[model samples]
Target: MKHGALLRKISVVGVSAACCIALVGCGGTNYGYTGGVAATVNGAEIQEDTITKYIQDFRTSSDLTSDDDWGNWMKENSFDPATVRDQVIDYYVENELKKQACDEKGITVEQSQVDDEINNMKANYDSDDAWKQALSSAGLTEDQYRESVEAGLLDEALEDAVAGDAATADDSKVLDMLNTYYTMFNGAKKSSHILFASGDTEKAQEVLDQINAGTLDFAEAAKQYSTDTASAADGGNVGWDAINSFVTDYTDALDGLSVGQVSGLVTSDYGIHIIKCTDEFTCDGKATSLSAYPQEFVDYISNIVKDQSKSTAYSNWFNDYKAQADIQNNDMPENVPYNLDMTKYDNSDSSSDNSDGSSNGASADTNADASATEDSSESSNEKSSDSENSGQ
Candidate 1:
């Protein structure tokens, strides 16, 4: 199982951008706050100061030097300053519950593990200054970052301990899953297609006619006329993806075809497609047997089964533990700094800037583990500068 899955509720930002700074002070013993408490998880106080610190650190790391920057960042991320305090508190509360559960199971993270995680994060940058800058950008001190890593490690250990037998599957289970999918999808099919622009039915029909007449080769027709450039370059091969992975129309057209059979002109949201079934895995309409499938396909299905087993195990364990835990959230304190008055910041100038402030597409509420590695060079900033640019 992925360690990130264990702490999804606690991670409030992407790793490359914020390094998951929200996780600070989430593990170890209680802070023993003398100030007002934000929450109480099984009689352990989550201090109001802790919530304030999280917001302050996030603000500092995001380089929100002015009210305008803060306001714009909030706007871009759809953050409601009024409820951010409650969100932070809730995340900490969940983290505390996980930590407590780990403790109950005698799960402990060694300091060396925390150090190694930090060292791995440091390796992602070139110099000490760059490392420090990343920490500051994440709004984390080295010590606080260590705490986050420790919490993540503890959560991972807890998952393994609790999941136990549910994390594995026998060969019988794998075959059963494959049989179900095969019966539902009428066995798997692989296809290649020649695509045309939407509404270009005349052009699509002409290409189909040429291929049907035996004058034009299917692969050559795809390479010459298909608009889906990525698949077209490879003779329009969509490969052996699961049936559900394709659009409804594509899958419907593919389902009716036998091996080496060419489909009539099919239309979907992606535009017109002339599909050819390259391969199939049906054992003469018998869904009970896998003898007809290649060993490679069986192996693929086995891995998927194992992954699903692990995920289901983790989910079941966490859900049960959380449901039984004594989690109590106190009301929000009146004087918390999270409630920012947007009226003070001039929105007219910064409203048009769609950048989420960070170079990566790190939002104030996204999942990232402490040990997560990401290439800083290739960020969402490079993919598309304008948030409105949703590429086809």
Candidate 2:
């Protein structure tokens, strides 16, 4: 559960990045998706294709294609149409999931119970003004943030109802499950590959034609042919990678290419595999890593363990709850990655009052930076500069 590991767990969607940016209100922007599948939960349509679009956008936004098992890495961490759901479900599900679980146990959350929770959360903010500022950064109004806090209480209540003895629960188990669940996740492997889900090499071949024709890009080709689904939308972006970091097919095919070199279509179990040597790096970090993105790696590892150790009871309780729950992912889409577009909400802004009458993560910044410069001229100029520097 290191931040390095969580790096893969992160949605690389361009739209997701936009949303992350949205939370910052750094010259807030409003971005939207022209198309993508809407999200549906229990037969209720959530957002029509908005989920898929967000998933795709988030995947494309991140520059994190670096891994030894790039193909599997992308597959495991494929974007979830959960930008909205992803953000909102924690509150909703934890609320309902907890409510239903607690109702069975006849346990009620008293106003006093919730009051303490709110006060505790407020304390974490240092002061009233500071708390409001933090909420604003997250695009939440005070009321909205409080509702989310209440939902946390509900989630806790439900966990107690179902799992029993909130102490000594299963945080490690959950983190372990998270670590083991996907190749693209914390399991640790990254690769570059081509996808042939088109059932034939025709599409992959077309990519080759483009590369050969000097028009189609290798990273873009990987994005186009990568049947890995999740990373495809990102044009096969692999981040912080090294040699032998990918599948055998990838490493073998890549032997002839130099750094930044893209190869012809090479076939793999997933589909056609293409290798791009974006970089050559060495891994020299310690075994320790953050449970999630190590935006502050040392601090997280240093403090998290002691905090969890003190909450062993809660962790144990969670373990039992998850064990008994009849959780299942039914009706998984064949093109699961297609169900989400990470960028659907990118650079788009929306402001609404939550039940508590507070605004939630709304920004109005529009497409100021969307038009990233073309790679050719910018890349060529940079390369020329590098060569000049080298010669001098």
Candidate 3:
């Protein structure tokens, strides 16, 4: 996904398309641009206006206006005008690439197949009217949402192109991806967090030390200085999640730790995290690992992982495509609002968390070093996992 996707931000938008369309569902008016073609793949020129509309629609739909927010988000995540433009070209190319792959292998998605998929989507909210209303409020037209859905379908088709061929070179990750949701959903995860806005390592470590020494009240300390306003105010509570979206460092620290165990600050592109083992919930009324859950949630986890695997595949495919395509960014900003340094991925107050369940930069991203700010309004999308790339 790191290489194939234009930027991980799109996955946030696209994630809504999959699990919760009402969340981070950006649908906006077209941004005008008749400056000719942006790039061409095998002589197929990508229309400048189409590319512009795509970017504008995403930006406008996301409701990102502030320079600091846009710069930080764009700089850190998987988005940039040129990067996105090339992604579109890769879509066109991959569509064709998959066509060749599928045709050579004789695989397909029929009208009825697509119809069933769309029906399942419509079933999520019941009635086209309700679905349309949700999309409308999110600033998207039926046409745009349909296209978004189609792209998702296309990504799936590419995967189905070689679903279970007898090749020794198997990507068990694909099976793992396909089955993640089903495994974890069956079991619920009862978890809690310790909020810390103090980017100071000493301060964060002190809080961890107190908790380990059985002195610091997890909820009390969170209320006092945790930057996470939302959780801090409400007891450092992050409701049940079938999958762990946190970085490896954070999860590894929590491994084998029993309920009531408090962890040390774990670092990531976002910032430091002090995860607490509150309680574990299960559909069967028993405790289990985060990796194992109920059948239904496990299925959900499967699709989540599947989509991510496909996303990664798509990214890799696109990068290879970009190498051959001639993309001249004649109008590229000399020193744009945010320098696209992969190193400067976090916001200015990245390490700040509070007991209030809100992060200092939760509502913003200012090109600093870390952040655990969750977007309450738009939190349902499948976040693009970071996989460091040589190119960016």
Model 1 spans > 4 angstroms off:
1-19, 25-35, 63-79, 115-137, 170-304, 341-392
Count of clashing pairs, candidate 3: 56
lDDT ranking of the models: 1, 3, 2
Clashes of 2: 82
Considering every candidate listed, which one attains the maximal TM-score? 1
lDDT of 1 by residue, 1-392 (tens): 12232123234533222434645444434334324777778888777777766666667666664566667666666665656666677677767878788778788988888787778667657788877776664455677667767777787787778775665657776667666656533467778888888889999999899998999999898889988776777787766534225667888888899899999988887788899989875543344555556564566565556546655687777778778877776676555554566654445555526577433223564443232112111122223211111101
Greater lDDT among 1 and 2 belongs to 1
Backbone clashes for every candidate come to 0, 82, 56
Candidates 2 and 3, the one with greater TM-score: 3
Model 1 scores a TM of 0.50
Candidates sorted on TM-score, descending: 1, 3, 2
Which sections of candidate 3 miss by over 4 Å?
1-31, 65-108, 166-392
Q: Which scores greater on lDDT, model 2 or model 3?
A: 3
TM-score of 2: 0.29
Residue pair clashes in candidate 1: none
Output the worst ten-in-a-row residue range by lDDT, candidate 1. Answer: 383-392
lDDT of 3 by residue, 1-392 (tens): 22112122223322122112211112222334445555444454445555455544545555444455554555445555456445444444444444444455566556566566556556556567876775666565656555555555555566545432221222354344334323444444545665544366778888878877889888787777566666667566554444445545555665655677776676644455677777665344233343444343444444544444444555566467556654443343334322244444454445233357443222322231112112211123333212111000
